[model samples]
Every structure is written in C-alpha cells, then in structure tokens.
Target: MQKIVILDYGMGNLHSVASALQKVAPGDEVVLATTPEQAEGADRLIVPGVGAIRDCMEGFIRPGFVPLLNRCIETGMPVLGICVGMQIMMARSEENNGVDCLDIFPQPVKFFGTDLKENGERLKVPHMGWNQVQQKIDHPMWRDIENGSRFYFVHSYYVPAENNDALAGETEYGVRIAAAVARENIFSTQFHPEKSADAGLQLLKNFVDWNGQY
Candidate 1:
C-alpha cells in the first residue's frame, strides 16, 4: 500500500486534505506527519496550507521539517503542495515581508497588487470562486481529468509564467494563475481540488495513484 504523509504544520487544512484522499485511497495509509522524521519514508508528501508565507516558512524550520522534507522529495517521493502550500513551492514570495521559500520552482510568487486583468479593472484582492482550468501539459496528476474543467480557488497571490513546459494547468481570475504545476517528481495546485467535489476527488485519486511518470 502506498504511504501518504500529510505535512502537519499546524496551519493547513490537513483534515480535509487527508479525508479527500481517504475516499479514493481506501487502503492507503494517510498519516499526519508533524515531524520531518515522520514524513521521511512517505511514498507521497502532501504540503497542505492556507496562511501567510512567512509563518509557513518558519514552520519548516522546526526540528525535523527541513531534512525530512528534503530527503523525501530528493529521494523521488512524489510531493504535492496545495493552496499557499503551492506558492511555497516557488523560490520566493513577494507577499508578506518577502518570504524565502523552499525553492522548488525558481519563479517567485507575486500578489495581484496592481496588475489589472483583461477587463482593465484592478482585479479583486482575493480571487475566490470556481475558475476554469485548461490543461497546458499532459501530466499524471491530471490523468483522466478533462481540460477546461472548473476548480475552486481562494487566494490573492499567484505564480507567474515560467518555463511553459512545466505548467500542467492554469486558472483565470483577474489574470491567469498557475493552477497546477508539474516537473519530474514534484507537483502542486493552487485550487483546492479537494473542495471541488467530484472533480476534487478524482484529483486526489490521481495523486494517490500517480507513479511519478515525469
């Protein structure tokens, strides 16, 4: 059975995330790893959060977080970050106090502070609602998922476009936001696919079943 370690940093929607996966991965062990050591041997690593970037990074500095997360991902364990968890996947975040992220992606996270969308209006602060996601690349995380499907989103910051080939999906709010990203054994999502009902469940199942096919 595959082992999924849900990173428990005390600020994420850990219960909901684990519950969502349990629906699809019936027999798979879903463990809430509060320490890095607890997550070291996980077959899959889930970084689930919904808070400021600064505090999130501080959480990683705790005892076993850094080494444990690094070991798991570097050893080819599939890692998936959700919501703000996804933003931390980037190298840096211009959000609160200029946070230094885990550097999973070289790009930095930017807030829709002043950038206006296609409508020429300053996009709302937090783009919270159901948005359509277009599949930009074929990835295991999105296997069997149809393109142009709607996913739930609630955030003010987003990842800018980088290497186009690394993009798996995109969502448009004020402007396009990185909805899903995949490169090698790492993957992440800005939308709460877990809160998206059927579409969300499928996504959880897909991640649970994913064998890292880069």
Candidate 2:
C-alpha cells in the first residue's frame, strides 16, 4: 500500500484532511507528520496550512523539513499543498508585511485589497464559501473533476495568474485568482478540497491514484 504523509507544522485542519484522505484511499497509509523524520518514507506528501503567512512560515521552518520537501520535489514524488499551504509554495507573500515562502513556484501571493468590486458592487475581503474553478490544464489531478467545479475557499490573499506559467485553474472574486497550480510532481490548490464535497473527494482519490506524472 502507498504511504501518504501529511506534514503537520502546527497549523491547518490536520484531522479533517487526514479523515478525507482515509475516506478516499481506504487501503493506503495516511500519516500526520510533525517532523521531517516522520515524513521520511512517504510515497506522497501533503502540506496543509491556514491563517497568516508569517505564522505559517514560522511553523513551517522545522530544521530538516524544507530539505526533505525539496528532495521530494527533485525525486518526483507527488505533492499536494492546500490553502495557505499553497500560498507558501510561492516565492513570497504580501501578507504580514511580506513573508518569504518556500519558492517552489515563482509566483507571489497578493492581497485582494480593500477596493475589490464586481458588477459595481463591493466584494468581501476574505473570499469565503464555494466558488467555481475553471480548469486551465488537463492534468491527472483534474480527473473525474469537471471544469468549473465549485470548491470551498477562505482566504484574503491569492496568487495572480500574471507571469505564472504553472497556473492550472482560475477563479474570479472581483479579480481572477489562481485557484490551482501544477508543475512536474507538484499540485496545489488555494481552495480546500477536504471541505469541497464530492468533487473534492474525487480529486483526493485521483491524487492517491496518480503516479506523479503530467
């Protein structure tokens, strides 16, 4: 059976994520790893987060975790990042007066700003609730999940599509936000698949079945 390690850096909905993974892949081993050594023999890695970027980074910086993550990326192990987990994959974020991230992707996370509007009406700052994601690429992670499928999101900051070649999905909230991104062995979602219902569950199952291919 494949072993899936969900990196628990003291932030994120760890129990919910783990429950969802177990529901999707009944036979697979799903572990919540608090340290890099706990994540050692993982066949797939999941990084999950929530709350402020600075706080997430502080918790993310375990002595050997970053190196282990980098090695996983280089070796083509399937990795999935969720919410602020996805944000930290970028080079940096505008949140908390600019926090440097893992730099797995070249994009920068930007704020939604106070003046966000759609159809001449002011939009909310933290874009909460369900929103449809427009698929931009045909990756295995998208298997069984329809284009324009609604996913649960709760974030004040987002990654813009500009200059980001890794953009795989897009969603609008006053402006277009990079809802999902993919490259080589990595796939990340700004939306919470664990909280996204059926479509989300299918996506998780697909990840469990995927072999880190394009």
Measured by TM-score, the strongest candidate is 2
Q: Write the per-residue lDDT of candidate 1 for residues 21-134, one digit (tens) a residue.
A: 888999999999888767655889888888888888888667567677677667787888898888877899988869899887777788877665666766667888888899
**Model 1 off-target regions past 4 Å?**
114-118, 162-165
Q: Following a full C-alpha superposition, what root-mean-square deviation does model 2 have from the true structure?
A: 0.8
Error of 2 at 185 (Å): 0.2
Candidate 2, residues 76-158: lDDT per residue as tens digits? 99999999999999999999999999998999999999999999999998999999999999999999898999999999999
The Cα local distance difference test for each model comes to 0.81, 0.93
> By how many angstroms RMSD does model 1 differ from the true structure?
1.7
Can you list the residue pairs that collide in candidate 1? none
Best lDDT among the predictions, by candidate number: 2
